[model samples]
Target: MFELKIERVIDAPVAIVWQAWTLHYAEWFVPRPWTLEVIENDLRTGGRSALMMRGPDGEENSSEGVYLEVVPQQRIVSTDALKAGWVPAEPFLVRIDEFAEHAGQTRYTARARHWSAEARDQHAAMGFEPGWNAATDQLEEVVARLKRG
Candidate 1:
């Protein structure tokens, strides 16, 4: 599998970071100039997280996927965001989020793995890194602000 990974140390606890992934906070971490509309989310293994978000161009993008793995405050794994909950969408992508304590600070990493090199290249060509990193940065900022209060 081909993968893309981004890691950063956020000034927040594990639990605080965990909340950022939930439906409540997800609404904010969505990339700007676009909006997220969550259709359903159970957030557990075998559960679904479906949404139809509109992009800046007024196009609606549908993402329906399931939670493949969930380890509270430690790790999360899920299938391609654009795939149906039951099937492996070709060029399938799996997202994994891992968190650990580093000198009392939370070290978090978000990794995205795709099925093939071409698929990985396509995602990169689509500006995956910049878009996702921006969203993650936004998530970090929100978590920090929430933790401050």
Candidate 2:
């Protein structure tokens, strides 16, 4: 198994960051030319979280997972290894998102735990870093706009 972590200090409060991440996720989950269609987002433990990401070429990738833990404004742990009702699914990745308050800013961390080195490498080769960075940038923009309102 392999793990990858990314962190960024968002210039916003933890609440704003959390709200952007949870409530407005679809708005910034993907970079330009790509779009995320949220099929379901329950935001509770054992609830389902599913989405279909459409690429620029119109290719669609679907992901279905169950929330393992949800701590409002603090953390969220989910895995595609299991579906709703804790039913076993093909193992892929476990994602953990954590938020912390640091000097009035939001310290955001995204961790991806893969089922194998090959899976991790595949994700990395797919431009995970750049893709995620761009998504975070978009998230920051969304949060900033929402904060202004």
Candidate 3:
């Protein structure tokens, strides 16, 4: 398995952290000033996962995929390997997100598993670490806001 991973302990309860992921993902999924537009959030197994990312330069990129697995707040596994209704497409990577109760906070882990080492390296070269880390930081802020209200 060629994988790239990021782990962080968010200073919020698992429930809030999970809510940030499930409900407020659009607020933190991409690093700003890149914006995300959620086309559909059918957060269930085999459901659609689609979003468009808009850059500050007016550049736009769309991602359309399907959820491979969903386990409530515990885990979310999605891939662009297949689209809705099992339509095959050009493979990129499978994303795995795991959330756990860590003492009084949330232990969050996100992994991108690619089809090959070359693919993994390509993803890393695409700024996986910094971008994901910034997104994770945004996630913490979202979680905090969710916790406050």
Candidate 4:
């Protein structure tokens, strides 16, 4: 197994960052030319977090995951290895997001643990870093706007 971690110190409060992530997720989950549609986002353990990303070319990629843990404004752990109710599925990756207040800003960390090195390599090749980084930038922009208003 391999893991990929990305961190950013966003210029916003932890509360704002958390709200943008948990509530306004669809707004920034995907980059431009790709739109996100949330099917379900129940923020609790064993709840479903399903969504589809529609590309400009009309291609769609859907992902379904179960929330393993949710700590308000602090951390969230989820995985595609299981759906709601702990049902086993084809394992893909475990995603962990952590938020912390740092000098009036939010320190965000996103970690993806793949099932194998091959999977990790594939994700990297698929532009995981750039995609996630752009998504994070979008998240920060949204949060900044929300904070201003």
| Number of the predicted model whose lDDT against the real structure is largest | 3
Instruction: Summarize candidate 3's per-residue lDDT along 42-118 as a digit string, tens digits.
Output: 99999999999999999999999999999987999999999999999898999999999999988999999999999
Candidate 3 has an lDDT of 0.94
TM-scores of the candidates in the order shown: 0.89, 0.97, 0.98, 0.97
Off by over 4 Å in 2: none
Evaluate model 1: give its TM-score. 0.89
lDDT of 2: 0.92
Candidate 4 lDDT (Cα, 0 to 1): 0.92
lDDT of 1 at 59: 89
Per-candidate Cα lDDT values, in order, are 0.78, 0.92, 0.94, 0.92
RMSD of 3: 0.7
Which residue pairs clash in candidate 1? none
| Model 4 C-alpha lDDT per residue in residues 13-129, reported as the tens digit of each score | 999999899888999989987999999999998899888999999999999989999999999999989887788889889999999999999999999999889999999999999
Q: Give per-residue CA lDDT, model 2, range 1-149, as digits (tens).
A: 59888899999999999989988999998887899999999999999999999998879999999999999999999999999988899988999999999999999998889988999999899888998889989999989998998
Better candidate number, 1 or 2, judged by TM-score: 2
Task: Order the candidate numbers by TM-score, best to worst.
Answer: 3, 4, 2, 1
